[model samples]
Target chain A: MLEDKNPQKTKLEQLGEFGLIKHLTKDFALQQKSTIKGIGDDAAVLDFKDNKAVVSTDLLIEGVHFDLSYMPLKHLGYKAVMVNLSDIYAMNATATQITVSIAVSNRFPLEAIEEFYSGVALAAEIYKVDLVGGDTTTSTKGMLISITAIGEAKDEELAYRNGAKPNDLLVVTGDLGAAYCGLQVLEREKEVFKVNPNSQPDLSEYTYVVERQLKPEARRDIKELLKSLEVQPTSMIDISDGLSSEILHLCEESQVGCNLYEDKIPLDPTVIAACEEFNIDSTLVALSGGEDYELLFTIDQKDFLKIKGNPNLTVIGHMTDKNEGAHLVARNNSKIPITAQGWNSFS
Target chain B: MLEDKNPQKTKLEQLGEFGLIKHLTKDFALQQKSTIKGIGDDAAVLDFKDNKAVVSTDLLIEGVHFDLSYMPLKHLGYKAVMVNLSDIYAMNATATQITVSIAVSNRFPLEAIEEFYSGVALAAEIYKVDLVGGDTTTSTKGMLISITAIGEAKDEELAYRNGAKPNDLLVVTGDLGAAYCGLQVLEREKEVFKVNPNSQPDLSEYTYVVERQLKPEARRDIKELLKSLEVQPTSMIDISDGLSSEILHLCEESQVGCNLYEDKIPLDPTVIAACEEFNIDSTLVALSGGEDYELLFTIDQKDFLKIKGNPNLTVIGHMTDKNEGAHLVARNNSKIPITAQGWNSFS
Candidate 1:
């Protein structure tokens, strides 16, 4: 349904590579002071001066990461930027610049690529990050996107996963499992459309969940929120590969154990409703359903009162000694070991 | 012939995503003091202190960038890193770190991925750059590689393409067109192999060209070479897309024209012989054939004596007024306008 029916399809080869890149990125003005040179060079020059730089990258393949049957090109481009930015944010740094490289097949027209870059421009504008440099080339098959995000922070202000200590309060931001549930809703609708192309199904009930999956935002506000509250996380990570998997990473890196309260796991109303309709356990969805783009962290016990009753922050659990091992405390008063059941592309 | 015929092949699914990355990069020791944190984290932390950072990225698709039938995974990995580093060196910066991400199909076993990483490790070791971070995931079809190289330099030490003056002399490092000629020899051998699978073709005569294509090196030594000689380039770029194309880039960026001497263009003896055997003009190959990874720059006329008669350097041309236009002064003394006949993947 999102595919363009316009007859004025501009072939990518007509303009060649240099012309295409110039045309696509002409309007991307540099916003950051650190970007000494943006684009139009062999490499971008960044002046971070006294601040430490954080770098993260990700590769998104068309068929493996997204299905164009339901996902739009604009959303894919926006999500690709978000995926890289989430890592920079997890480091408690301010994202200053990003480089986006894409390899696409000839099947896509120049207009289609423009649609994708429109979303990227929107993200860069909203996030206040400069587009530094990138490469554009043609692939043999489907589309491939690779993004590298660079951020900066003071050495003392940076957070690492190995800093969490015993008795630290585990915290989470916003809600979880919504993005995964949204994917499920989209997949089901795709099946329905496949059977009857003319069917007009009502999707009002899934608006929240569907939008969450299509245009999820990285938590760029939490850093400022914590600073205002005078609370610093001892350890932090983004929930991209699900809560359980990320929690395990924190535990392993910090050499500590965690007791996560099953009842305390945050879930949006739409996600709960979709879980009941889909006949799947909401807890399972919250634990193993990845791509939430929310921050999960641990703060000192002394900072617990500072964040108490904040709608955006939730006190989910606490850290324990290494010998206790990581576990999930059930509502029935039983404990179960937490394992990595997150999405594995290889599997 | 390069494909492994071993009986035992470990599936990539056996290690999963995180396990695979950890296994591949476990031996990569942190070499740069600027790299505060490398791998195993949400983002790699770099402390550039008072220096400016330079960043460049590239994406390589299997069928478009290489053919696995002739290109081994190790050389592909090594060459992918070189492509990005060439851009860093083009800026006259010291490369410090790199992040590599790849997406491959299930057809590649764990051993094949290991072979690729071995090449990456070797490049990092020789170049003294840290393997800071990367992402590994499964693709739906063939393989895809994306690399981002980070470098550091003082503000005054950096070279840009837009710094040339009217009287600056254009210079090139090493010889040109060998890599492109190497590709031609390899293609011919592939055709020969197709005609007779049992043929044991002798490639000794084509060794120099073939190795130039497969194992080309970025001129990391050029920065130090220029510094030692006290001759900084006024404008610089890597010769990846042919000398004519790169010269045009310098002219466009610096708002100047160029007059290239056909007789002054450097060509190795092996490249000249290969050109003759293939019945192609050596000048055309040196002008349009790319992937040389040699440094091309313009220096002030006063610094000409410092590099004169240097075996590694060749004064090929000189900058002129923008109205003069870019041209190649052929051996016959005819002026021909230079255009970009460089590789465009879309075409």
Candidate 2:
């Protein structure tokens, strides 16, 4: 049975500009004490009281970040918000609100924008953050999405990735490589769909992987989990531009070295399978895949037992002496120096 | 000796990223109590206290908002930041910090980037706003600049464009049409250069006009001036998209009509000469050339007495009842309805 495409979807012109914004952020709920107020004002109210705020911004250009051919506008919208929240999480703060600025072309009908906003709203609902305010404009070129996320934590509670000490345990939340595998599956399916008009993407088997890529979650829970575990990490950073690149950032900041254990790295079965099918090295995929939004922190050895048996937590390695330099050990017990291939949009 | 370039000039590479940031924002002193911390942290700290925060974003794409051939990199960078700061200033709040993201191709050598940053840093210093953080990356096409400015003020202190009431006075700061005239001078110079490669622009006479376009200020001084004058505008907005377009936005929000006297409209001598030279309607150019960044505000009739004698403040007209509709009273007594040819990038 063919799905019907409705010809009479509501046009953006039907509702005025303010109406569209109100409709888009109707269900967002503020979830943190630091958010004295969220949205409905000239600016989002961030009453950090005595706490410090962590702010970051990123831009995702159309045709550069994702192709609309296979990537749904809704997923694109959701992922756009995710990438920015990832930076907030990297600073070990709870993201409370975001400003989404989107510049769309005339080719995008009102229905398309609505679908995209629906995805943005859904992510907001799940993340428990407010949409607050943003600027909507017409773009001269392709679609442009600019997101700025604001978060808050106590001045003393905030964790930076540059405070690691020697012997601190290196731990990562959640397994890696699934998102990269998901991307591979999507690219292959896109090619297949281009060759045929009637074929639907065989995405059922790749659901886990695809979701990891298209609708990845920020580690908001990890912040809570770490709190309940009573473990204050000496240093923390989010895994975004590959684990290797992020590890280098931590090393550079701390002025120390690290030794990552190859055997200790965790991978899901679907990720393993996709790596083999794509002829990609699983280890490299895990290290350089990026977009995982997982927490990579250095914890005191004394607190290791608190999260020792937790399935979601994996002890990847340990910090080394300052002169040892950063390296990763292979399965054969040979140490290899780390190199970075961070995300470079300009290229 | 040809002084086209100086090798002894300060090089940006010598300072690096953090040093450049410190060098740029070292002089900006936070004037608002809500600004808990201006810079030196992951994000600029804001303690909104009992007020609501209003945030707005703007993105400028190369070849759309500017023509590099007619614009200096230093001025373009400064103007870009000023435009975004103008938005926050429009809300009548203190603009404390901003996040800037630029996408440039490899064609922009490190020196070119340094030039851009120097301009941005200079603006940050002049405006007294901190350069908190931003992302710099490579672009597939031309340069794209995205800026997000955050500001805070008490809830009642915000001067929304919708707050105007019947019989209110409409006022504007500084003169209009100068920027448009400046743009014309640059375009003419560009044409002259194209005809004869050895030709040099004779721009000394157009200094004020050129500066108005290239290094336009965000009217931060007006905020302080307004406070000193003890006038809280009932309605406020920045002049960017044109006087007609901005006045209409205020009318639509405030639900009031306005009667603008044609003779009272501010204009510089350079604007008059350039408009005459270009055969462009002075009124139309003043209404729609965009990028002035001056304060367009409405004050209650009772408070008009305070600013009536001030040189910087000019009374353009008075607000009328909604039924009267917005119109301009020409010299011949002809009434022309106001409409928006607002700056829409796609259009």
Candidate 3:
């Protein structure tokens, strides 16, 4: 990431606090009219006038969330913003502004931080969201990023996890399990690199899966697409901690049950091939392998015709009465309880 | 502080992610009517109707922001919220909600996290702000707290640091430097404890100063007081770094200069006594000592009479033409150019 040929590093202490903040955030241009004031103030001011405001925050820590050995700092920044924005999209709101805070150890030079912010700026621009205020400071260990995304929507258009009905058709936007397979590929490459420092592994075949893991995009377009298709999800959530975990959350909150069809679960061809190559079950990976920033929601049965045969969406499940319990209908016609074996940070 | 004599420990891995979050936040009641939804959703939803929204965030790293050796986890939690809320109050807005995301190492038990959340709950209750949303995750090192405070105010009632015009009166709420002196006392005690673990140092005389460091309160009431007194600040900021640094921020943002009076700077008797004991100049302590969490603001000349004799408010300076530059009027009536020697996290 260091493009400077001289390789002479400038320490963060040399720039001081204000100078560093100004340098890192100078290129961010406020885009949202709701953002009355951005950085350079005690707090960012937003005038959401009549729109209901939505707020979501996430914390990404090094070693636990991402390994810098394979993950570039630029992609890390982009992924951080995307993760928070995914939560906003789950609320069926238009993501408008975000605050990016970071705490880094002194080992990282000014250029490293600049590279990270460049990624953040790129994500903000691509998402059409304004970069608002945030804090930067020192950390005792590795870097940690905390992002809070703010969005706006009308009261009626907003979606909540508890709005599902018994007949709601469960749906997921885009394909899943690619990010997990991508992570597996990266881990294998890292192991190979450690054993032989000069070895260069060809990653061209795993390009799609690797990109999914490294630069997963939040389903920002899903909300607008659903609007145009006239399908309003009764309940919604982002698939962060895997599909099974999020489905269970929706069922529990809505006081209903879900019956997911294993055969209907969406998966990219790359993910299927990688699953076979790694001798792992693609169904299990789709159910429990997390980090896929896809939108998972349920729509009323009446709206099924509107979303039927949509290439970007798959109806993998349907809501049922609470007594039915959450389960998956396996392709072999056997029933299995859906368990949340998603990634747990603590363990 | 673990007070349970039995000392039975519960590992975080036992509860899992959802259980941990629910256990920590179960007692947080929504106090604000504006909080349409709190936890149990992808994002917290708020209906502000017409009031402008304000957002401020802060990241408090364990070693970088607070030394846990002397800082009780409860007080650390309380101070973390106060630090973020102070920024909102600086905007002349009432803090209504906060999202506190914490990343903790595996070393911290459930009870320790409970103690910290108790402090957070206490602050939220006392301030009448709702604990709307947050993310709790595992870190590779010590604990880090990132708090995002959301507040609201009418567009016309809001204050920004760039509103001060020439001839505006510089005002501050409460005393400064006590938090800094309080840190000195704590550090000295920590050193003493390091030498002899069994030694119990007498900190009775330093009670006020030490408490200022351990549990500093944001001036939440000051905003209400200004409204009640029919006075609005032309420009405002919270003193997180130091007086000199915050003054320079207002000066730079407003495109004006300031002349602060050394005599008018507010200091408690405890701070003065502690400064003498530490063999440090009280003026320098007041100027450069950070983490005061006091409000520094400017008022139009007509409002000066309203705040002049108020014990809670002190007029320390006035805005001047930009060419005059920011300076401090010493006790000897000498002019000294003020420099921002605020606490640099990098250093």
Candidate 4:
């Protein structure tokens, strides 16, 4: 539906693999002091002297994690990097380098790959992460992107999911459910375009939510913001798989149950409106809708006052004893056991 | 043709993505002192104090990189790891950890993934590298494997492609072209099996060549061997691409040239026999056939005596001034310009 007519199509075979990689990455200058070597070599060398290196990898497959019909290649590339970097930020690390490998089918032209790399370059430039090493190859069917994000942190500054204690306040950065609501708007627009090709999508009302989905930024500021507030999260995880699921992960990993208040869940106005228009419950959307890319964390009660009124932060819940189990206390004052409604690839 | 008709198949949907990852990697214990945290978190943490970390990544797509019709899931998993680790070894670094991410369609049973992970486990155990982090997801088509290897080395120990100078003696570890010949044998056998499924063709004669393709190992010993000999290579690269292409890369990056002697190119007797049977020139196979995973390097001429007559090493060529250009001195004393005939995914 989004196919461009008379698009300049340069066959990928013209450049081959090495030529394509060089052409795409030639402009990326090494900015990080930790990067001793970036690209060109068989491996990229990084010197994180006396610091802890955090590494995370994620794979995005076409028709599974994304659809090209709606996802622009640039946005796809940008989102792919964001997904991996979110993990690094979740560890309270400063993302320093990333390696992006992509496998494309013959259907894509060289220009398409250039657009994708442009997005990657933009992300690396903005995030201050060096594009170190990657492999480019061909897939039999569709495009597949695998990204590994590497970051650095001091030993004492890192946080893990297993550190939360009972009575700790659960906090989340930014509002939830906007990205999911944005996807709904896009899917509806896609359906409309399929029925009538000439129909143009009017996404003005969904600007915030759609941007949240298409160009979501990793919570790179959270680490600094928390530090400025003199608040250190006892446990942290990125909200990629919805709030309830992530809360459960923190609870299970830390061996402490959580009382997630449904009323306290933050939702953007656009998300609330979209949910109402789609006839879906906003609270349920916040609970199960994912791709928020927000930081979900817990801090000691003593530090709660330091961040109580922060515009970007919301106190959503509190930790409980392991025997209490993870539950969502609804506005109606009834407890609902939280289950993993996260997206399951196999299912 | 190699399908197991009555094999038990466990549906993957029974275990979601996280469950599958946990089940597959449950046995992988952290062996590297640099590894601060392995799996189960958002990211893996490593403390590479005062050492430079080398990182490399590779993606293997089904049908493009391997034909599962003959390639077992186990070998594919093992080979994927080897391909990435080879890059680390090429950098003269000790491989310390790897992150393996995979996307498989529902066509593969849970048992198939288990089989693949078993091979990964074996590689990790044998290589003494920790399995740090990975993401498990579903693809729309066939299986896809992406691995990122992380290693470390002292500042001066790492070798790069841009260090070869004029008069440096070119060297290679182990025999070449065997893996390419092995692929040919496997392909021929696959065609034969298509004609007669019940014919149990004995592969004893093709054992060496076939194993070279199916279960190739990265040259992890070459670094230690060179250290023991007190011979340091000025430049090095792994033979993922053909020898000619790798040599060209070294020459181009180092601003030098080389004259690779055809007669000195190491090839196993089995490879020569296979080349003869296939009616392909042994020289061309050794020059352009890739996936050898051997270390190709250049050492200063002064260090030749240290590696002279070593069984594991072969002096195949010598670096020349950049104005001389790269060429192959054929057996009859004819110098032919080298070209890249390495595997091109787009082609």
Pairs that collide in candidate 2 are A42-B54, A43-B53, A43-B54, A43-B55, A346-B138
DockQ list for all candidates: 0.92, 0.31, 0.91, 0.93
Report lDDT per candidate: 0.92, 0.78, 0.92, 0.92
Q: Candidate 1 at residue B67, lDDT?
A: 85
* Residue B126 in candidate 3, Cα distance off native in Å: 0.5
- Compute the lDDT for candidate 4: 0.92
A230 in model 3: Cα distance from truth in Å?
Answer: 1.2
lDDT, model 1, position B47: 94
Ranking by DockQ: 4, 1, 3, 2
> Over the stretch B1-347, how does candidate 3's per-residue lDDT look in tens digits?
44334458888899987899999999899999899999879999998888999999999998889888899989988999999999999999999999999999888888889889999999999998999999999999889999999999999989999999999999999999999998998898889888999999898999998888999999999988999899989999999999999999999999999999999999999898888889999989889998999999999999977887999999999999999999999999999999999888887
Span of 10 residues, lowest total lDDT, candidate 1 chain A: A1-10
Global lDDT of model 1: 0.92
Per-residue lDDT of A145 in model 4:
97
Compose the digit string of candidate 1's lDDT tens values, residues A1-347.
23335557888899898888899899998999999998989999999999999999999998888887877889988998999999999998899999999988877888889888998999999999999989899988888999999999989878888889999999999999999999998899889999998999788999888888999999999999999999989999999999999999999999999999999999998899999999999999999999999999999999989999999999999999999999999999799999998778899
For DockQ, candidate 3 versus 4, the one ahead is 4
How well does model 3 score by local distance difference test? 0.92
Worst 10 residues of 4 chain A by lDDT: A1-10
Interface RMSD of each: 0.6, 4.2, 0.7, 0.6
